[model samples]
Target: MPISDDIKLGHAERLLAQLRESYLQDLPNHCGEIENLVLSFDRKDPETVFDEIFRHVHSIKGSAGTHGLHLISGICHHFEDHLKTLDGRFEKIDGRFINVCLAYIDCIRTAVSLFEKGGETLPLENELEQLRKRFLKNNLAGLLVSSSNYITMLCQQTMGDLPVKLTTVDDGFAALERLLQQKYDFIITDKELKQLNGVALTLAVRASDSVNRDTNIIMLTSKMSIDFPAGLAPDEILPKNTGLSHALVDAVGKIFNGK
Candidate 1:
């Protein structure tokens, strides 16, 4: 006798629900650790930082697979390949390269968030392809510039000719302060900065006014581990090594739709 398809569908839904809950409970902490590693990259000893970053990437690759985020997992796997090439060598981390990596993280975080919200499609494939191209380039600044352009293009695509105000802050603290004084629908930041760092800044904002408490926060970083503070929960955390334009656009859509 053929089994009932209805029963099978119900079972699948239950299993997916269980996995979603588990991921929600554990993802924040894992991402926080990665943020810490990203922030410490400039200040820590080169050998230690390299090992920490490598481990962070490896962990993300493993966890993403467990959560069924195959695109994110694949991206992490490719990034790990690059990191492994520099294992034991004391190479100075390039700022441009770091920026590109952060963009990728932002994309993954946004995509995962959308999935959790019942979104049926992912939007950042083109940006990811562009990032893969930049990954082959040795010039760090060029990569950063390319990513910036990609982000701008993404915003235009999602919003349809609407201009988004773009401002660069020196660090997370400044960015947080600016956010508090304004009515921004969304805020994006790197995990590491000269002051406060992204996680701390997020915590500070959430603890402030009631209106800002639920504001969307997206963090970008190249670190692999995710270890954020308890009170400083961000809406999303992205790995610095992926293309994030689609993720950014999706976040904007959610905000505009009042989700």
Candidate 2:
């Protein structure tokens, strides 16, 4: 007889608990190593030190996901992006940058401590939000996957007045790669992209186990009627028509307004 799903789930939960335990035990050392590396920055070989710090944070993010510490993984994702933005600017690695880097490391440490104490970490989450607002590109992140200039223009016009940092990709595969690595507030995709169509991309996003599994997806299609597969339809589908701009604006408004 086959093992029941409940039994399988029980086994998986136990294994995850063990992994989390191990991760919690080693998190301080990981954070300490990162902190020490940052504090001991050497201008003689900035590239080497930067790469080392990146690698450590990258490892911590991946491990956090494996151990079901999604919050830590999310924070690390943003921190990694923050680091990447400063990669080539060696001179920018000054007091402000150092302070931001230290704050990120401390955020991870606080998260771990709160988790161990079974305490509410919502305030820490808010602090991270405030930090992102000050140091990162935008408080909200968005991805736009479209090959149409008109669509791109409309999206840009709509998102210009908002506090969203939009990243554009012309292909679905590239969009998928971004989705897997980062968290986004919403995604706007074209239905007839060259490599991957919008429907197929939506299906992939919905089925993915990444941070963006439930992200809002607005699909733009030239066709008036599309038979989307069950359980794979995008949040909003707008046809290519005269009112597209208005519809797109409304869609973006609802998304930002949390409607």
Candidate with best lDDT:
2
Pick by TM-score: which candidate is best? 2
Residues 80-136 of candidate 1: C-alpha lDDT, one tens digit per residue: 544554546656466764675566566666656766786744355556556655654
Taken over the whole model, the C-alpha lDDT of each candidate is 0.59, 0.82
Worst 10 residues of 2 by lDDT: 132-141
Q: At residue 186, what lDDT does model 2 achieve?
A: 86
TM-score of each: 0.44, 0.64
Q: For candidate 2, give the lDDT of residue 250.
A: 82
lDDT of 1: 0.59
Off by over 4 Å in 2: 1-15, 42-44, 137-140, 144-186, 190-259
